[model samples]
Target: MSESTPSTGASSPLHVAVGILTQGGKVFITRRFPDSHQGGKWEFPGGKIEPGEDTLSALKRELREELGIEVQDARAYMQVRHAYQDRDVLLDVWRISRYQGTPHGREGQEAKWFACVELPQLEFPEADQPILRRLWLPPLYLISDSRRFGKDGFLAPLERALKAGARLVQLREPHMPLDEFEEYARLIAGLCHRHGAHLLLNAEPESVSRCNADGVHLNGKRLTQYSSRPLDDHFWVAASCHSAEELRQAERLGADFAVLSPVAPTSSHPGAATLGWEAFSRLCATANLPVYALGGMRVQDLARAHQAGAQGLAMVSQIWGANSIERAVTALASS
Candidate 1:
């Protein structure tokens, strides 16, 4: 097996509970008991759902029992399945932003609040992930990402995309020179916002000050290393995540959204293997952020992404691959 490659194996069946405590853009977490399963790890405070109990009702009841707080208005986030040597299981997760009462652990668990942007430092359990992603970003935006922009590029195409109703735009020019790239980014960011779309930078924080972007996009590298709090308040942040661990971290970082890649391997990475639908759903089921599947993805994958609990799809080639922006937007919107 190649290093960094994920193992493909059958999943185990286990029920789990998790909570997302959001206060002033921060989430509260619990340090697991040293004697418990995955002990000493940090996680959202929740537990298994009873056979007849609904997931939300179970979460609500668990929170009140474990933390001494009453939860209200809970929504489904994502579901996750993990296989371990000793045990394998599925976790149904949810997010509750409305709650009452001061929470303290009545169950003898140590609890603390960390700003969402700083969650990497905490030891979070894997099951609480998908819930994190949904809370961190804006609804996912699928857009075109072509490499041919120059003097004759950008304004015309972006305008067309906006007019065709493409809302989320990522100005990622991996091959372009810094100066030329910044100019195009600034140009497109303005056009997107003018059309009432959300514009995200492809991880050039320094350049964002000069552009009218709504947020920044951190590639997996930046997603693993950087914390987002120091950025200007006007700017929101997003990240690219490829795994359950990455998705969890994205949420902890207060990202506005995350791009989850290669649900289906594309022309760009043909040699890359795809995450089969079942595992993809399992991974997505765990994150709390709105996830957009990137890499080798097509408009057809939108329904799959949504059913797996993702907010929507994010694309590059497909958005720019069609003969016209109108075709891509129409297909995406309909999906």
Candidate 2:
């Protein structure tokens, strides 16, 4: 995430709701008219929410008006606040769980369904780029906890995890010396790139460019300090959040996702207060970015996390063994 380009005025942002309607493996998208704002760009089919409307109702109504489909079931996905040159807009994005009727462009716009992976190649508004990246993430985010497995010992299991289909990895060695950490990050980044997984350097924005990593994961303190994301749009920025306010701050800083911690009691920090699933879901609902349930989470908790509005789970100890790593990713991919 890079520093947000400041908006000139302090006007209240307009609220808009958008839908990602899916069928099979494809999601529906629409192209904006050449003469409209963000003209000639591809976007998910949706329109603005009315003053009295909630996101769900607004989504359902907008889908009918824009695409001639009735949304039967839909789930809130991500909320995005973007400042364009014209206006500051808050997008309430939802994933259409189920819908009825054939979809076509009712307003003379072009509509198409595309496989999720193919979306990046198409042109979209700058605000929509984060949403596209969020879609590429897998359900399990593996954070390297080298407490038990020393620096040298962690690589093998990590490799196994990557080979087994772990699409997201975070190299989080806070205790390691800078030199050692850089070396390890470089090695891990190569492995991740080779396996088509994305690697994030924990709390080290400066190291990302040096280590060839995909992004940086800010600790809570750094999350609070930085008003903008450190990197450009090509990099993925994430933060560790302990409370709803932190999660909101992460979104405000343009973070692509956040890992909310202590969702359950943890062995490392025994007796620490946990958010539990109910509280975790409550916090997640407020975030426009994808949220991962961290601290004491494991592969088995992935489905529950998703139900609680988390994009996935971020586990430390549970993802460190070859067999466990393989199984974790297998379950994640299957889920």
Measured by lDDT, the strongest candidate is: 2
Model 2: per-residue lDDT, tens digit, 254-306? 88999998999987899989889999999988778889999888777888999
For model 2, the run of ten residues with the poorest summed lDDT: 1-10
Please report the candidate that would top TM-score against the real structure. 2
For model 1, how does the per-residue alpha-carbon lDDT over 1-335 read when each residue is reduced to its tens digit? 00112234543265766667788867787777886777788778787777788878878888998889999777766565655556665667677878998878778888877776577455655544434444444333755455545545646776776787776778787777888777777777777878867777785677777766667788877787866443543466778888888988887776656777777778877788777667778887777766677766666777777788777878767666568878777677544
Angstrom error of the Cα, residue 289, model 2: value is 3.4
> RMSD per prediction, one decimal?
12.8, 4.5
Q: Can you give the lDDT of residue 168 in candidate 2?
A: 91
Would you give me the overall lDDT of model 1?
0.69
